[model samples]
Target chain A: MEPRSSGLVVLVLVCPLAAAVLLQLFGRLDRRLCMPTALAACLASLSLTGVLAGNVARGMPWVYHPGNWGGLGIELKMDLLALLFCLLIAGLASLVLVYSYRFIPHELAPRETSYYTVFLFLVSGLLGLSIAGDLLTFWIFMEVMALSAYVLIAIIDVPHAFESSLRYLFMGALSSLAILLGVVLLYGAAGTLNMAGVLGVVRAGANGQATLALALCSVGFCVKGAQVPVHFWLPGAHSAAVTPISAMHSGLVAKLGFYGFARFIFFVFGTTAAVGVLKMTSVLQWIGALSILYGGIMAILEDDLKLMLAYSTISHIGFMLLGISLLSPAGLTGALFHLLDDGLAKACLFLCAGIFIYRDGTRSIQQLKGIALRTPLTAAAFTLAAFSLVGIPPTSGFVAKWYLVLGTLQARRPFFAAVMIIGAMLAAVYAFRVVFYMFFAPERSGALQMDDVPPAMLAPAAILGAGTWVLGIAAIWILPHIQRFVASLVS
Target chain B: MSQALSYFNLTVAFTVFIAGVYMVATEHNLLRKLMGINLCGAGVLLLAILTGFVRRGQQLADGTVAGTNTVVPAMQWLAVAGIVAITAITAVGLALARSHKRVFGTMDLDEKRNGVKQAPPQSTPNATEDRR
Candidate 1:
């Protein structure tokens, strides 16, 4: 029965990937037909993943035995946490693909089919990363997602776009190398790259050298996750990509780092007090706080709107890291909640930015004055998402922040709690800076006249905005579920 | 004395990482900066691999695989694969640099930024604009 379920998991991931290959080959023959076919594949996989996640959340871990002839090879393990993240990945992919149907035509009409085909493959890679229980498989999926992104970003016909893609490729490949080395060290130390196997080895007792290896492994993941002090590539790479790609990168892809952290902390190391694991968590906390402050400060100073949003993502992830670092129930819950909220908010902001670029050919905040009057729906959606970014009341962002604050207080880290407040204030500044520029900034006589977003695009943005509201108001309903999931992870 | 030996390795790796970081920070030459990043990565990889070796000869005696286990295997494969991938990336970067060099006749990091030969005038507006 378990083997059958594992087969189902592999099929769920592979079907879209196969579809991606087919779409790429056949895309040029009938450009108009490509989008629907690719979208259908994503939707199908999204549904299957949904069912798998539901089963897992009901306290059944989905384990896929790779092939009937079993060796000590890699297996896909879907615990509740993996299920939640997979759902986020699938959900974000669906929304972004729907949004791109209309948006891509304005940006790249001739290549719309190719764009989405690559996009679906990228989604498959992300889904694979979240669910992969083996280190080697995780690394393979990580590269697939990243390389596809490099292609997608460079697909735009702008000079800066190409240059930025090259920069992203350089940084991404380097970090991947670091991650590889880390994985190797862990494999060497434990003699098996399986998360369960490693945990067993580490749990035996503390060894000075193994502790150092663990630290190295965490650093590699930290680089991949774009944690502070190693986050130089995020802003430039994110802002320079086409907006839809930007949405997927920030909303879904960056969270892989946090997922890696979560897996290592709970599954690989267990909840035991060892010098190495202790240092990693504390370091993660400090880095999270620093990233929050650094990302916020830089975001406030940015003139380019997309760049500002990109930096803001770094800052928000800082808060997410803060929660995870606490290693408490409330902290884990808050982190998970923020993960969901941040994905929705980022998708909204990126889509809003896409609309701006679509209607009027600019992303300069200064040039976007009076945009609210012209595109009221998009303006409203943007405003809602911005408030969510600031963790304003009645938004899930608020719920996430509230839980985090409480968790920090319970952890007796008042100073860190103060830092969270300051980060929130900075979020207000950066988010409202965009709002003020769009609505209240004095209108120029020749601002580009733009139309309201088409229903295709508007629909997804609306759903995301509603999600923010749901996560904020009904948070208690979902909070305990994530807590139980985290408990399962730690124990 | 063992502490000194470890510190010495740490100092060397730290110096390489710092130098790599500095080149990444200041150098505009894409390939040069990439080399710097590689240097930094190498430093860190050395530190990690060295630590993996340190646990060797510790008297566990239980026949349990220690340093030669899962982490090391994955790291080794990852390292080999990483080098191969980075080399491919460098090749592409070089091709891009050569193309730019052909147009501008120089690939000096600063010159690549400052010097822009005028783009050939577009033959078709919609054709050019549609690509965006």
Candidate 2:
């Protein structure tokens, strides 16, 4: 089917870019306009994405070419996958920006303008990446995202923040180089930078160059996604950023790496014939499994609340990767669903952590004893989000985990299914430990007298916390569309 | 011999890339690591430039000169943009390292050797207290 040509796709990126530029220009004069402008841009993008999603669901994917450069122009294709990612990025960004209204004033009072500007830039880059139809465009947007993230991570100017941000920058630069090399190699092999053209070349036959490109790209993305061996930068970087930034990094930025990987594996590399020759799937599967166990164990051992949540992000990433590596329709469905579920749950938890820090200035789990009594709403939200992460029944996490297990069984990899179960149990141990500290443990002597945070901050966390359950209950209506998309991808 | 000479730039690119990777992996000093990252970026940009040449040669062999000029300029533009990005990252890295030195009084990343006083994790209570 010929994709319906539309110009509205560009507006999704334009909204954020315009807002960022506006903020950079006049935001200093009146800081009060900053939050409203940023929030408006995000909501505009989210609603635009919702409209496009509706169109895409009606069997008409929108494709836009920005310039008149014929084959050389960049293509922005809004298919089901792209729309799903756009929805997640814009939707979560709207919430995080709302949370930032109250959060940023406390954290970076003088630098609110720069913060919002950079934050909007980051959102634009992520949205651009989701819809990027060619390799070079994807790389460019990836850099935009990475650079903004590096700035946001170090924006606080604390020594540890700078150190961790520097580490992340170096690693990110290396990964970008690796990815660029892969793109160059791919261009050499396929003679085109367009993803559709590359798919055609790969389906004809896999060459050594193509396989090497795949390896380089996969390695780059793995580093970005915080797979086991190269995951050292993640904990420091995620924990060092301000709360909303931390939420964005853990909840959205890291998942873009997985999105890039999925696009390449399913779209560019085609299917088992090419990937099987390299035995890439099983290698990735093993790596994902190792990451799951390592991240889970480390999370359980961490005493710092944010650090524990950061580690759990790694474990959840492993689950998504494992789902993708299974290379089944069911697995892809589970992975995509988990991406949404985990993004909401993790962001909600981070926001809750922010509230705790705002109240008592402590992220130490042991120091947070009986925090529930003071900030009852945040505690309740944290528990619900934690339950989702642990894959308890009637939560969104359970639905995604169920599909992943079913996927493993269908692929005849019962051992991986067992691994998934173990990973969930590990998740339970860490998630529930935080809940236990917040509720059951006795209050410390110096505990601060504080109530729930302002409604601005509390609302985002509460909405996301409730979103996880709502998504779970609504999965019956959602999963079919996801399955159909997954089927289209594999076939 | 002629083929090897013709592909000399590719060889140099790979060599530079490997050297950069080595320095980045082993160097403890922040400045050296930044240099290494720049080198790695330069190598990749060089490789990208070489791709244009390789493509042009293939096109010439196929008796297609219409797109030859276009390919070279496009690659050159890509290289230029890459250089700008590398410079931006270098600037950010340098600024970060400078502040890091001001805060901790050393540019060495090795905690034990430099006896660098590590700041408590930013999210911790003590750090927030310090800020307050």
lDDT of 1 at A325: 84
lDDT by residue (B10-56, candidate 2, tens digit) is: 57887898789899999988999999999998898887777766433
Provide interface RMSD per model, one decimal: 5.6, 4.4
Off by over 4 Å in 2: A442-450, B1-10, B54-74, B116-132
Worst 10 residues of 1 chain A by lDDT: A65-74
User: How many Å off is the CA of A169 in candidate 2?
Assistant: 0.5
Real A-B contacts recovered, model 1 = 0.18
**Per-model C-alpha lDDT, please?**
0.74, 0.86
User: What is candidate 1's lDDT per residue for A1-491, written digit by digit as tens?
Assistant: 13225577887678679889888778767777776877787788778887776667667788886753233347788877777787788788888888888888888776677688879878888878777877767877887787777778766656566566666766676667556655655565576667778778878877543565566667766766677888877887788888888999889777777777777777777657332445667878899999989999998899888998889888888888888888777788888888989999988898888888888889888788877778777888888888888899999999989889887987788888899999999999988988887788776444454456689888788788777887687887777778787776544
RMSD of each: 5.3, 3.9
Error of 2 at A444 (Å): 6.4
TM-score of chain A for each candidate?
0.94, 0.98
